[model samples]
Target: MFEYTIIDKSLENKIILITGAGAGIGKEAAITYAKLGATVILLGKTVSKLEAVYDEIIALGLAEPAIIPLDLKGATKQNYIDMSATIASQFGRLDGALLNASILGELTPFTQIHEQIFNDVMKVNVNAQYLLAQALIPTLQLAPNASLIFTSSGVGNQGRAYWGAYSISKFATEGMMQVIADEYENSTLRTNAINPGATNTGMRTSAYPAEDKDKLATATDIMPLYVYLMSDDSIAVNGKTIKAQ
Candidate 1:
């Protein structure tokens, strides 16, 4: 596990947006952020799942979380721009954004990769992230300090056999993070990427169905690094990919 002290209410009065907030790591992060006193904006494709998370946060007496039911695969650049505009209009500024939403395209031989699957994966994991980051950078700049976190994978830095478009998309994600970080290096907005190594999520299960999930770390177990990167403590850390295991 990444070693970082979890502080109480470290994110107080912050406005944070999290993609894939409907389930898995994204859902856990949303609730955790709310517990730390952040007004979390939950963005996901499933309205019911987002609502369930919202209800759970409200029941815990945490900060009230807003939900944006959006499918990245179908959403356009203007959609992302409008979403950011709405968030800005309501919250005044965004303190953090976790771009965690992604699709794991079928794992197959490099030569056997399907065209449609590759396109779909790139659409969600690459293009959508590009659009979202472009739209959110302005809002993030509004804060005294802001964190922009992109989700990456082990295969992103080191290629693995049969990972296909999923791996390629993550490579693009890392590249995007670096480009954005470099551009905003001297600004209040700091950009970084997190490689949540081998967490037991639905996407992991789909990619490795026969693996022993009991032996794998849960999403909650890896949140220390997530919280650390989003907090003011990490204001000096930028343009790097850190592992959470």
Candidate 2:
């Protein structure tokens, strides 16, 4: 048996923020959440892509989602702060946030990794989450309950050759979830990580170029867990990494 697909309207009126929402898993999750009645804030680097997702959500007659064009790699602390302020001013609180944006640096030997690539990966994947968390905690607290979801990877827990900086960043992503969860234990925030195993996203294609793409699940297939975690149904689940396969 499996979980994550039992849908309910419990997410009605919830305010959620999903990073990297332009495409891939993040985009799919945003649409799914909107259908379930949550007001979603789409954050991504590409305005056009974000607009497309926004149009889709609106076309479906779901909640009108908001868009924030943000490049995680270059986003500053003030950007995070301004985002939090905007969310607070607009919605008064934030019920959930999925840190779903990440970049996989070159899949090469660790010794062969270029410095810029490494920095870029770490900055987008790890540092951005830290800054966002710091900025959003107050807004999250304004909610009755809040879920902080991190997009983790299997390679984060186990180091594999050629995974390089991407792997390292994932490991740190999980650790950040644990640390944040521990610190927020008695608070309204619950931090958790989800590892979307072997999904059919562009990132997966780059990682396993020769693999049979048809056999892999699409981004929509892994969205059940995203919905469950963001809904009140999983408020008790905290400080753990879950696989979305």
lDDT of 1 by residue, 1-245 (tens): 99999999999999999999999999999999999999999999999999999999999998889999999999999999999999999999999999999999999999999999999999999999999999999999999999999999999999999998999999999999999999999999999999999999999999989999999999999999999999999999999999998
List candidate 2 stretches off by more than 4 Å: none
* Candidate 2 colliding pairs: none
lDDT by residue for model 2 (110-191), tens? 8999999999999999999999999999999999999999999989999999999999999999999999999999888999
The list of candidate 1 runs beyond 4 A from truth reads none
Clash number for each model: 0, 0
Query: lDDT at 64 for candidate 1?
Result: 86
Alpha-carbon deviation at 92 in model 1, angstroms:
0.2
